[model samples]
Target: MTEVLLEAQSLKKHFPVTAGFILARTVSSIKAVDGVSFIIRQGETLSLVGESGCGKTTTAKMILLLEDPTMGSILFRGKDLQRLTPAEMKEYRASVQAVFQDPWSSLNPRLRVGSIIGEPLVVNRALPSKAIQEQVRELLLQVGLRPDHDDLYPHEFSGGQRQRIAIARALSLKPALIVLDEPVSALDVSIRAQIMNLLKDLQHQYGLGYLLIAHNLATVRYMSHRVAVMYLGKIVETAQTKQLFSHPQHPYTRALISAALRSRPDTQDEEIVLPGEVPSPLDPPPGCSFHPRCSNALPLCSKTTPVPREQERGHWVACHLAETLTVATRATISAEERP
Candidate 1:
């Protein structure tokens, strides 16, 4: 197996809810990320997928160390994140970079593309201005942009072009892992494939690990080596890209797959629509948080929480009816098309 680049073990982040403004006392906690675990290895992409308020972004935040976990820990290259010293923390930041969802907002509009791309190198390494500009030019070329484009401002570039600039900025640090929080979700449909293909090619070239947070299952299927289905702040299922889509075991996972496949004209399976909105994190349902929305929830599902069971090779499910769940008859999604 490839070396593990980052590992999250039973990670949980709960934000305290305040009741009063006058010396606010903690009323309750919103379980934003409750008991989520996964590993990202070198040269692999692991995507976390779910609907809004499902804790996908929160999980990413915990992994990125933007929010400290209340219950669990994050280990990067075998070093505990929460325990990292000042020097170690700086190293960690350099080793792991991020590309946000909105490239336009991420980039500084006042700065030129060259300065934006080279900012990290200047900040971290304090490289000479001439060297930084040369490196920036090379990065621009790597991302399918003309070197001369660096002279222009952020407003001059199109959405896709701005995203390329954002990507180049992320690449400046030469990080081992990149947290791509909906990297292409903001781009046009025609440009998504280009960005996805660029990301894949970059990973192949550099053996970079990606922790992708995206709601678009098609993008997840195409860019990810493995997929972890999350629901209501917990992971419901995790499996290889092909296996998860074709043989989803958990009801929530199945529903998510069904919804994703609904858009494909060739998909024979109907969308497994769940009833009701996702439960609030402040007061989630007992046992399985997804039980209230699960269409095929068993009586036991509402009474007892299920532990993650390894159903097959590397495939895991946390559901009451996992053993009885059958493989999907629908065709496997093909992700061979690339620019």
Candidate 2:
């Protein structure tokens, strides 16, 4: 079995909602990530996909130790994160790094590329200044940037180049896992492919695990070994990448897959347009959060939440009627595609 690099067990993050400006009291709480769980293995990629405000970024933050979970535990290499000592914390920080959506915002404007990439090394590891410079040069080469470009500032590089610089910084520490939060969404369509290829190459070269938070199913399909679908701060489905794309059991997953593949000429599955807007996370609807937008919703869906159950080997779905609904959906699509 592959070694699990990181795991979250029923993780939850709830921000307190205050009522007044001065002497405010807790009125309610915004459940950003509620009871989410998954694992990332050594050298494998597990992606989290969902619509905006569905707690993807929040989950990433919690995993990175930027935010503390309100309930449950986060285990990094079998050690609970909240219990880490100061020295262990430093080691943990070096083990996990992140690349954000906007490369320009993440990089320092005033610093040269070499300095930017060397910051992690300077902080985390003790080395001579000369050694850091040599390491920076090698990192630039690894990320496909010219070693000579190290002298250039952030403004001197294009968006994709800046992203490469950011990637170089993340790699400086030789982290075991990297949290990629919308890494390619900000780049152009042409540049996106290059960045994706660079990431794939880096993963292969370094044997790094990735926890990718993305809205683009296409990108997820290309990069992920496993995929987790989040809806209203809860995971609705999870499976191997091919299995989830080919046989999504949740209604929201089906809708999103339909939306993503609708433009492709080879698509045979009929489009699933969901009704109603996503319920506010501040005050989500009762029972299953996706019930409001689900077409095949049952009375049970509105009154009782469903837990994730494995309908097939390693394929989990949270819908109450996953088996029947998925079977019906496949039958309808098959009939529609018949000559």
Among these predictions, the greatest lDDT belongs to 2
Candidate 1 on 2-109: residue-level lDDT in tens? 899999999998899998889899989998889999999999999999999999998888777788889878899888887889988888889888999998799998
The number of the candidate with the highest TM-score is 2
Q: TM-score of the candidate numbered 1?
A: 0.94
Give stretches of model 1 more than 4 Å off: 261-266, 327-339
- Please give the lDDT score for candidate 1: 0.88
Residue-by-residue lDDT tens digits, candidate 2, 234-322: 99999999999988889899899988865567768677888878889999989999988887888999999999999999899998999
List the candidates' TM-scores in order: 0.94, 0.96
